[model samples]
Target: MGVVSVSLLRSSVFWTVDDLQQAAGRPAFAVLTQNAGPLQLKDGVASRRGFEEDLSALHEFITHLPAEFSTPCMMFTSTLPREGSSTIVAAFAAALARAGSKVLVIDGNLHHPSMHEAFGINARVGLTHVLEQHATLQQAVQTVADLPSLHILSAGPVPPDPFALLLSSDLRGLLQSATDRYDYVLIDSPPAGRFPDAFYLASLSNVVFVIAKYGIVQRQPTARLLRKISTPDLLTSGFIVNGALGVSE
Candidate 1:
């Protein structure tokens, strides 16, 4: 997310906002609104619609993500959730749709999930149900509107054993299933210090990319924690600094 003016979506003149933002030395992946509010046009304040500028930039961003990584597995973390991992992952999925890639965004942050909220999906049935083996894939998967190729599986009601579920064989099978169904599986995991659920999932991913805030403290013990996750196969490791909250903000 980044500063956004909905009206700018309609103007070919504003198409280069991506380059401008990237030039600012802090490029962002924006989850812009579908509606561009009233703006000055020849017919007076008019709504802007049918523009793909923001979405196109987002597509470029997520499409190149896997290619940039050393492995297919990607681990994303935030110094904390408020720092922006969920937003990034969800938007990344949305943009991935634009890039002609079929993507499934799993809300792996069980303690307090946000994928459903970001996508405006019902939180009653999803990955939680699937992991519990209580729901079929069709019953759990929700298609993102306006983004035909992007699907979301939110972590439903927080289960008592999110960690156990992370290590469940069912999860592994699900990942395998996803690999065959989609181009990429983007998971929105929890903060490193908040829980170890993500660590377990990261081990299964092709690559793991971490997330750090522009400025935040990670109180977790570094060496011991790193040791627990040590693995030669873990690749495509990187960190992103995010601060934006909403498109209009």
Candidate 2:
């Protein structure tokens, strides 16, 4: 099953109008599309000078992922607080939408979720409410008004025990349901050292995207996290070295 389903490039869902439409801001809408007339990523701005080349690499990377991940890849990303995991996660998601995949980005960092703020989405209801109140994931999810293929699940409100909330029977079920519906699930998790949320996501996600700044990913927590996960199949999806934006002098 893993080998036959792992190729993202071969999936019919990866190339369709429905994928882009779903990503057009419905967090629960998990279709990163390639079959539309022509895909156009809407929400965020792409880096003009280097975006094309950058995403070329990213696209190659995503499509080449292990064949077992083809059914729908589950990748959760996080970092130490202030490591810019949000920036990287959002960028990668936007890129996926541009390429033609139905993408659902759920802000799982309940303690401090910024998905709403980044997209200018009004979070009247978010993950917290969706899980606690048994609300519809579609209702809490908002469409990226201008972006054709981008959806987000905002962190609705702070929960008393965020760990229990994320690992809740219902929320986990929702995540499972999401996999069958979307092409890629890029979850934004809290810093590994600071909370248990990362652990929860690490346990369930097929892959983990670890973001460490130029100098900040020390040996302690990262090693600890790697050890904590402790499974060969459970892998680090990617390592993003961030915070090198510069002024071309």
Candidate 3:
């Protein structure tokens, strides 16, 4: 077993990467509903019924991860836009933090940056700056006040060349650094069918969670999207049928 370090952050517990690796596997894909408006994390607590249910489900999923995914670094994307993938990814991070694990959520969807807004933080400096060499990793990460164990690297200023930045070598370095620092790193990527960026991000992930909104994403297209990404053979994959559990949209 790897070296495990555990610390109590106020009422919540925080664990080091070694601890998570030895304790259990990564979480499974979860299908959650999209809030009609926004997810408010006042004091780092999620209050909505749907949100709480989803968080609990995610916590349950963590116990059954495969051996290969014990130290999971994964990405979440959808077949189409507005499928509630970003929201699910955010909830997953919160769930991990609540479990007393150090979590890092990176906004890799440069096309639509929402992680910063979700956490109510300034997106002035993040992955973009770090990739461009304008800022260091320490400068780009924003620590959540309510969840001391959760850190966010928002998608900074919209670059004119989004793909170029994502494909840059800097991203690989940053990702490696994150792996060493955080117990789990969840990246929120853009829709797979709409942009190629998701493919690139998925390549770096240990597992990929594809979200398909019920009544929104058709079955045909979802199958096609899955087939399209199977070329390199994704490390591990799962589906989150949004609204499938009768959660409000």
Q: For all the candidates, what are their Cα RMSDs to the real structure? A: 11.0, 14.1, 13.8
Per-residue lDDT tens digits for candidate 2, residues 183-204, read 8887888887788778777777
After the best TM-score superposition of candidate 3, give how far the Cα of residue 45 lies from its true spot, in angstroms. 10
Per-candidate TM-scores read 0.66, 0.72, 0.79
In model 3, the Cα lDDT at residue 45 comes to 29
Candidate 1 worst ten-residue window by lDDT: 38-47
Best by lDDT: 3
lDDT per residue as tens, model 3, 156-225 = 9988878877786478778888888888889999999999998888877777877766555555456556
Candidate 2 shows a clash count of 27
After superposing candidate 3, which stretches have Cα over 4 Å from the reference? Answer: 1-28, 33-40, 43-45, 66-68, 231-233, 245-249
Using lDDT as the measure, name the better of candidate 1 and candidate 3.
3
Question: What does the lDDT come to for candidate 3?
Answer: 0.71
Candidate 1: give the clashing pairs.
73-206, 73-207, 74-207, 75-208, 75-209
Q: Write model 1 residue lDDT over 1-249, tens digit each, in one string.
A: 233654433331212324323323333344333322222222221112422444455445544664544114345665445655665566556655666877888888899887787777789998889987899766898987867898888889998888887777488788777767778788888886678887787787765545433323232332233434546666534334343223232
What's the CA RMSD of model 3 in angstroms? 13.8
Superposed model 1: Cα runs more than 4 Å off: 1-73, 218-230, 244-249
